[model samples]
Every structure is written in C-alpha cells, then in structure tokens.
Target: MSGGCAVTLDDLTVALRALRLLAVDFPHLPAPDVDVSPVFPEWLRLSLHDTSCESLSAFEQWRTALRIAPEAVDSRTQSGGRTRVLKAEGQFAGAVIVLTAYADEPAADRAPAGQAGGVR
Candidate 1:
C-alpha cells in the first residue's frame, strides 16, 4: 500500500478502537458523527452534538481515558462565530484522532425569535 493508504488504514483502526472505547466508557453519550475522507485520510473526526456542559464533561472524561493531556483541550467557532465546538486531539496507535463536541446551536441563537433581539 502507498504510505497515505497505510496511514488511512491505521487511522480507521484507531477511530474504530476509540469509538468502541467511548461506547464502553461513556454509554450515555450519543453516537458521534464520524467523518473520514479519502482526500484527508491522515485524520479522523468524531463530532458529538450535546449541550456545552455535557460535551465539555464528556471531552474531559474521554481525554482522561485516552491518557491525553488536559492542555490539549481547545475550542473554535463555526457559522461565523455563532457556533462553538470544543475540541481535543490525541493519537491512538500513532494515528491522529480529533474529538469535537458542540451543541445544536448557541444559547443566544436558540433564544425564541426576536427574544435575543438581533437583526437577521
């Protein structure tokens, strides 16, 4: 296999192992949205949609379970800063795995129409 193909295989293996671990360790968490593209086979992303509180809690727990450092935690916004996603990156079996968790929408965005009082 080409080097990229081998790395992709490794990434898939790591992602499956991580998912199995999370299923066993954090059964209450909903299944994440798994994504892997042939174009970017070196990385894997598992995204969870949960309340920020719940997502943050799970992120910490998963990182601890994976033995990833607490300092790995980070965050970024999407939808022009209206959506925030908590993120952590770690390696399993030498393959990069990224865990991202975010709520369906920001609290302010979820406010009843016209309640938050901002222009559309």
Candidate 2:
C-alpha cells in the first residue's frame, strides 16, 4: 500500500483481469486462479499450482515475517502441488503475484515468427 501510488479497488480489479487472461492463455506453467470478494473495501484471493511448494511457502512466510500489512497462506495439494492464498483488507492496494506456467518450448515455436502465440 505504501509502495508507490495509492491503488484503488478498481486498479486491483484491472490487475486481476489481466492475471486471469495470462492464466487462461498459459496453463502449462503456474496458472493463477483469482477470486475477488464482493465486499466493500475489496479483498482478493489468488490460487495457483506451484511445482515447488517449499518456495511458495517460503514466500508466504516471508511476507508475514517482513510485517507486511497483508497476510498470505501457502497450502499443499494431495498431488504435491502448492497453492498460495493472499488476503488484503480496506481497498487493498498492492502487488499481486501472477504465476506464469513455463513451457518447454518457447511460445514462438508454436507460432510463426513475428506472430503472437495463442491457442487457436
């Protein structure tokens, strides 16, 4: 919140939308599922499948250890995948982690040179 510019709820919404698009467009990596609470002030929940649970958990722990206003919890899946949940209250204005799934091949491999890569 005290990073730079004061972010409004609307800004968070826009960021969430962008994150969703990235997830849908790139699912092989860390595709994040974002859920925004419809309450006043605004609250955001992000879920993603991380191959490295320890790393994600460490990140969640670091957030709290640093005394960050927001709180984050990292959970593990039965399949050994990791999920992270972050919550912020009162017009939460801050950065949201968007995990992008990495592909073995470059996006360009699936697309003609100079063309954008996307599912057809």
Model 2 residue 109 CA deviation in Å: 40
Clashing pairs in 2: 29-101, 29-102, 30-101
Candidate 1 displacement at residue 39 in angstroms: 2.0
Per residue, candidate 2 scores C-alpha lDDT tens digits across 1-120 of 325556565645644664555456545443245565434223344443344444355434434433444423322222112222233222223434322122123233344545444432
Candidate-wise lDDT, in order: 0.63, 0.38
Off by over 4 Å in 2: 1-31, 39-41, 54-91, 94-120
Candidate 1 clashing pairs?
none
Q: What is the TM-score (0 to 1) of candidate 1?
A: 0.58
lDDT of 2: 0.38
| lDDT accuracy of residue 23 in candidate 1 | 67
